[model samples]
Each structure stands twice: as structure tokens, then as C-alpha cells.
Target: MGGTFDPIHNGHLVAASEVADEFSLDEVVFVPTGQPWQKDEVDVSPAEDRYLMTVIATASNPRFHVSRADIDRKGPTYTIDTLRDLREAYGPDTDLYFITGADALEKILSWKDADEIFALAHFVGVTRPGYELSAAHLPADTVSLVQVPAMAISSTDCRARVAQGKPVWYLVPDGVVQYIAKRSLYR
Candidate 1:
């Protein structure tokens, strides 16, 4: 399971947990992307902050862990490269699952080394409102949909809520929200 995970919100946790539970996964290693490719269109919270928040958010879950592979790579975090490195690191015997959102699946064809990514690990797509998985350009038959609570609260929305002095309690883990506040992030 991997993403830029700018602030590790509730939606990400729920979706990842649902997938892991459904598949009876051993553990869900949350991988944070270093330099996200889509960052050209949007600003992310600092990588260190995002990584720290993820660590705080998933602390209670014994099945959840964080991977700094992409962050350590220190360049544009390519999904294929992460998958490849994880594949090697975890060894051939380990079953690897790559989790992402439905909108991403819709545009999976455009990713660098898209075909190899599908060949590498099982893919799980999480859908929220305004995004649906159609039969269009989905990678072969490797991608499967896992339905969880469609959290409308995105990290961006939560940040805006914080900036506006509105409550962000329901958007992310309490610890994460507090960390964001303590750091004066998204201000």
C-alpha cells in the first residue's frame, strides 16, 4: 500500500485496512512517495512531516507499518521503482499488494512503466464519491476494487478546515490532527 500520503487521513487508513482485511493480508506497509509526480499540480506537506504523521496515525495497528523506500530514494518517486525495490527487499516468497484510488486506476495507463507495475504486484483500487472504476484502461485483470467508507474529507480539505479554524477531528486520526496543529502545518 503506497501513496504520497501528505497527511495520512482517515480515508487512507480505512481504505487500506479494508483491503488488508478483505485479503487477509499479513501486513500493510504504508509507503510514502518522496517527490510525487503529481506534485507539479499541487503542493504537498513536507515529506518528513507526512512521514511522521503516518507513523503517528498507524501506531496502534500491529498490522500496519511504514516504509521510507521512496523517501530514501531522494528523487521523483516512481511507483514501479518502489514496487521493484520492495519486491527485492521482501523477497520472492512475499505476496505484495499495491493499493491506490479509483481515479488513479482510470489513468494507470499513463504511468511510467505501467505494464510492469501490473506484472509485479496485485493492485487494489479504493473508490470514493465522484470517482468510479470503469472498464476503461484498467491494467489487465490485476486490479480489483475494495469498497470502504467513502470519506469525503481529503487531506486538502482537512488542511483548509484547519486553516479556517474549523474542526478537523473527523478527517484524520486524533494524534495526526494534533501533530499538524503542533507543527502549525497547513496554516
Candidate 2:
């Protein structure tokens, strides 16, 4: 699963879990973007912070792992690049599934190297709250639309909660809650 994963909330974990189970994937790697091209206008927390939080959130899950390929790439993150990197690392024999939110999947065609993306890996578009999932625009053989456990939780909301000095205990993991408090992120 690839995302900015600004704080690595429950929704992310749930989506990854669902996709892994549905696809019978050996492992689900969470790739946090180094510089989220789409959200460049807004302030994103440090890449290290986001990476560590992702690690913390997925630490206990044996099937879940965090990858720093995007964070360490040192450039604007594009989905194609991510897929390519993982493909190269895992080799040609392995099947790679690019898991993303339904909203992002809607814009897949607009992304650079759209054709190459589909050729590289299968895409899984997981539904999130308020996002209408439609595979009409995607290739039937390349994309799969799935409804994960409905989670209204968003990283943006979690950041806002911290900024407002509000509690975000259950919305995020225990370690994340503590990390946010210790680092005074979004304050």
C-alpha cells in the first residue's frame, strides 16, 4: 500500500489488511511518500517522522512491513516510480499489487506513465469514507475495487486534532499518539 501516511492511522492498517487477505498477498509493504506531489501546497511533517510513525503503526503486524524507498528517493513521489522500484527489488516472478485509496485510483489515468503502471503491477482501489469507487475509468484486468471496513479517519483530521490540542488517542496507534505528544507535531 502506498500513501503519504502522514501519521499512519487505523484506516490505513485496515485497508492494507483487507487487501492482503483478499489477494492472499505474502506481505503488504506500506510506502510513505517522501514528498507528496499532490499535497505540496500544504505543510507535511518531516519524512523521518512520517516513516517512523508508519513503522510504529505496522510494527506489531507480522504481515505488514514499512518501506522507505519513497522517503529515501529524494524527489517528488510518483506512483509509477514506486511500482517500478518495488518491482525491481522483488524481481519479475513476484506479483505486485499497488494498493491505494479509491480517490487516488480515480486519478490514475492522469498520472505520468499510466500505461507502464498497469503493466508493472495490479492496482487495488480500496474504498474510504466519502470516496465513491468506480472502476469504469480503469482497465478491468488491471484494477480491482474493494470495500474495506469503513473508516472515516483521515490523517488530515488527525493533524488538525493535534493542532487544536484535542485528544487523538484511539484514532491513531498508542505509539503514534505518544510520538505526536512527544514531538509536538502539528502544534
The lDDT values for all models are 0.85, 0.92
Off by over 4 Å in 2: none
TM-score of each: 0.95, 0.98
Relative to the true structure, candidate 2 reaches a TM of 0.98
Kindly give the stretch of ten consecutive residues in candidate 2 with the minimal lDDT sum. Answer: 129-138
Question: What C-alpha lDDT, on a 0 to 100 scale, does residue 172 get in candidate 2?
Answer: 93
lDDT of 2 by residue, 1-187 (tens): 9988888899999999999999999999999998888888999999999999999999999989888889989789988888889988888899999999999999899898998899999999999989998788789999998899999999999999998989999999999999998988989
Output the lDDT of residue 35, model 2. Answer: 87
Candidate 1 Cα outliers beyond 4 Å, as residue runs: none
| lDDT of candidate 1 over 1-187, digit per residue (tens) | 7777778898999999999989999999999889887766878878899899999999999999998899889779888999998999999999888998887777778889988888899888888777867845675578888888877757778878888999888789999889988999988
